[model samples]
Target: MDTSFVKTPQIQQLLDKAAGLQESGGNPRLKAIVRDLTEALMALIVRHDISESEFWLAMKFLGEGAGEIGLIVPGSGLEHFLDLYMDAKDAEAGRSGGTPRTIEGPLYVADAPLVEGNADLSSDPDPDAQVLHMTGTVTGPEGEPVGDAIVHVWHANSKGWYSHFDPTGEQTPFNNRRRIKLAPDGRYAFHSRMPSGYSVPPGGATDQLMQALGRHGSRPAHVHFFIEAPGYRTLTTQINFGDDPFAADDFAFGTREGLLPVPSRQGDSAYIAFDFQLQRAATAAEQGFSARSRAEAG
Candidate 1:
């Protein structure tokens, strides 16, 4: 037989106090959420008998790895869970038949070079990289084209590193990132080199936690996109290369069906043709990209 201290009335009172239950001036919704979260965390600490030393070490990790928290969230499936939750809510609200959303990994930099219709993502070329060309269209649930949709795309370089965040200082600013404003037909095309899969920073915060949990922090070769149109809901999604070995085992759990497109080989170039289907927006608020802060280039 076993008993937990968190279940005791004393611990409950402590949790209430810590969660601002007795405060009269704080926001009710925020306070209520904090109270529930604190209670759960306290219960977990008691269940695991977490030592003071271990707890402090975790706090230190969080402090040092604050920059990588974005990676950690998706790597730990929190971002994926958010997608699932949002999908369920949409289904409940009678919304269906649109491209599935996935984790928008932490690498996107805003204000990439915008082009009309066809564009090139790689402003700087690599001699060792193979050329790739991709074409796509954005349409509605009824197969009608969503004209004037913006296709914002980005991907890692062949060496599995992104610009702005690459520590080697080898990549040019906004390398392999572009925003293509589709023509009235809702069609788009781009030229770039294939991206390579990348793992988390070795021994960094995300890596440390993943290693402790016996998991890997690698993502498959993928291209992220933000599709926005006037009357359609903005979509945050990506296309994982089906041929990549890590496609099915993405550490970030970002892999989604219909998003994995196998490229066709042609001498030194590869071609991928994929399209996007978006549902019409029921509210004006859904017509724009999320307000979450993101990195940008001047």
Candidate 2:
């Protein structure tokens, strides 16, 4: 049987050959995943008329940009897709009343400072930056306060550069990052400088791809959070500055309506109040796992 690809009939034969070349009996789930992926790639190639050179070029890009691939996922909407899928599952399971989830960007660093209730996150603050006082309460779906919950938050600097990613010449690993344990009443507060909008690094793979698609890789001013408690599902989310020009036009598509923080000010510092309500964990594996805690466990 000639499996040459002169016609559409050879597509199935090629797919079968590619999927069957791998030995099995080790991780059946991985085998099924590869098989499905192979079929999907085959279909995509045929439907789009992708040439040999084009496929090879894409592979080359992947090889060169492997390190930045994780960063590209949110920019290309996969991170948001996962969040939406999880939300759908939560709704189906009747797990409602939590603050809406958002994408965790690629800049998260493990093991930030664990502050007591009501601490300042502006470690080494800029002289000209405006201060921000953020206060919030974490609660359960049934309206009970969740004490001892870890409320981790990080954001960009006055120049829109993150600490670790931008290579700040500092001894500490975390800048503008803090982890505050909720008070006995489930309340937590932090004071930090208001962050500015940031864009993807220029001349990188993500920037190149964005330029090819006629898009800019700029994100609005926002603060990231990963909140977790003993009996609730982990919440990875962000609070977008509602008045920012790019608030509605984030390149990562992460600016949901519920995640936008209302703007207010008082006496030389800004204030934003947003409460977080988390759902009860449906399973044992879903409870008490935070980003820092997971990193520590590993």
Candidate 3:
């Protein structure tokens, strides 16, 4: 028998010490978890002949897995987890009578320009796509207008690239992005050209991981929002353009029936109006401006 492979009472004592440290907490449930982890690690050391190469390989793979977390989070459905949790909380509190919440997406820029009623937001100089007029009211759960609500909006161009992230930089001067504060009646509107659906970055780390997992990386054509007010809970959601082929199949699983914007063709513009209802802030501490303050500070 190899002396290096010998099992010793000191090894058992060290594991017991680890177990004791984990169990010393006041929570009984956490103590049980400590016991379970200690037992599992001890068993693995005894049963599996884990070579140094295999150990290093496991560490390497874990690092790669950690790096892949953001890719998996958006594509593998964890973004919806927040929505589901909030929905359940709203339902429990009898506050479910608002526009459903959706993911804010990773691309939303916090400090976009604030414009009045109908500002042209299209960055494309040619303007080949149809101009769109989107209007909406921000109302409370009791149907009262939320006059102070701010509506932040962003979307891609016809070629499926956001101004900041696209390599072209042709539209880099903050085109197709703006924020509007609701009027005294809690209404706001803006104009922008319709956007096209685009796949996630192709032939990159995100794509390589998706390809290895036999998955396609694509998101439907949609506009992103971060709506907020003094007392109401902040709402982060997206309005999907109805015409995209992947509208129903968003890889982020963010589509909701009530969140889809109805499209109508006017003489020269596509018209969309959506009303958003928000739940009132239940606590005084929750009524502060943390989200907006953070953005402003940044």
lDDT of each: 0.89, 0.81, 0.74
For model 3, the superposed segments whose C-alpha errors exceed 4 Å read 1-71, 123-126, 266-268, 284-298
- Model 2, TM vs. native: 0.90
Query: TM-score for every candidate vs. truth?
Result: 0.95, 0.90, 0.75
Q: Which pairs clash inside model 3?
A: none
Predicted candidate 1 versus true structure: per-residue lDDT over 39-119, tens digit per residue:
787777777888899889988988999999889999889999999999999989888998889988888998998888578
Model 2: CA > 4 A from native: 1-17, 20-24, 168-171, 288-298
lDDT of 3 by residue, 106-141 (tens): 556567888767667775663677788888789998
Q: Considering only N, C-alpha and C atoms within 3 Å, which residue pairs clash in candidate 2?
A: none
Runs of candidate 1 with Cα error greater than 4 angstroms are 1-4
Candidate with the larger TM-score of 1 and 3: 1
How large is the C-alpha RMSD of every model relative to the true structure? 1.6, 3.5, 6.2
lDDT preference between candidates 1 and 2, better one: 1
**lDDT-sorted candidate list, best first:** 1, 2, 3
Instruction: Give the CA lDDT, 0 to 100, for residue 173 in model 2.
Output: 54
Candidate structures ordered by TM-score, highest first:
1, 2, 3
> What is candidate 2's lDDT per residue for 3-100, written digit by digit as tens?
23434557665655556645554666766677678777766777778899999999998898876776688888898898889889878977667889
